[model samples]
Target: SLVPLLKGLKPKWRDSLYYHYFEFPSYHMVAKHFGIRTSRYKLIRFYQFDEWEFYDLEQDPDELSNRYGDPKHAKTIAGLKRQLDGLRTAYKDNSDVRAMPIEWRKKYRPGRE
Candidate 1:
């Protein structure tokens, strides 16, 4: 159950972990796999370290989250990096998936950042 999985987690840990690893990606993958689209702007945006990210799953499903700049989630972010790397290597995804420049202020908005 969710409780067992999230046991012993601090409230903030639970919030970030669930949001990054489970809730957001789950929603993104299911929607894209079925070709479902929403009018409410389904972009996933997060600030990890210092930079911001914007992912449009209609274009990229494998890359569901941006963990480039968030130090708070460093370990979680690193694990995700390894996971993504393995998946990419397994599928022979040679395309450079490295972070690219984005209008941080515009995409994630100022107050939110």
Candidate 2:
């Protein structure tokens, strides 16, 4: 299923791909990891450990360094976070819904962005 779809995907037709997976039967902490990727950058967020990572794909294709929490990328991190949040919201993601203040979400929930 995935192979056929992915092989036929046009390079310009998409902006990013986000992936999430959870382990069952053998592990409980696996739910904490997920990744987001764009042509230019990739970021992985690990919730349980509060660990987040960033990579400038163009500059470091091999992914030898971890740029998370780096001051130079704070703006990038903020921007990507907004995008990730938007994607989650669109899919009716409610994992973090309770963590948001009702009034705050109402102010910027939709077209406001």
TM-score of each: 0.29, 0.61
Q: Clashing residue pairs, candidate 2?
A: none
Candidate number of the best TM-score: 2
lDDT per residue as tens, model 2, 1-113: 46656898644456877765445224453434567789998887654334577999999999889897689989987888887877767766555322234464345333422
Candidate 2 lDDT (Cα, whole model)?
A: 0.67
Tens digit of per-residue lDDT, candidate 1, span 20-54:
22232353432111011122112232322133343
- Candidate 1 C-alpha error for residue 66, in Å: 7.2
List ranges where model 1 is wrong by over 4 Å.
1-68, 96-113
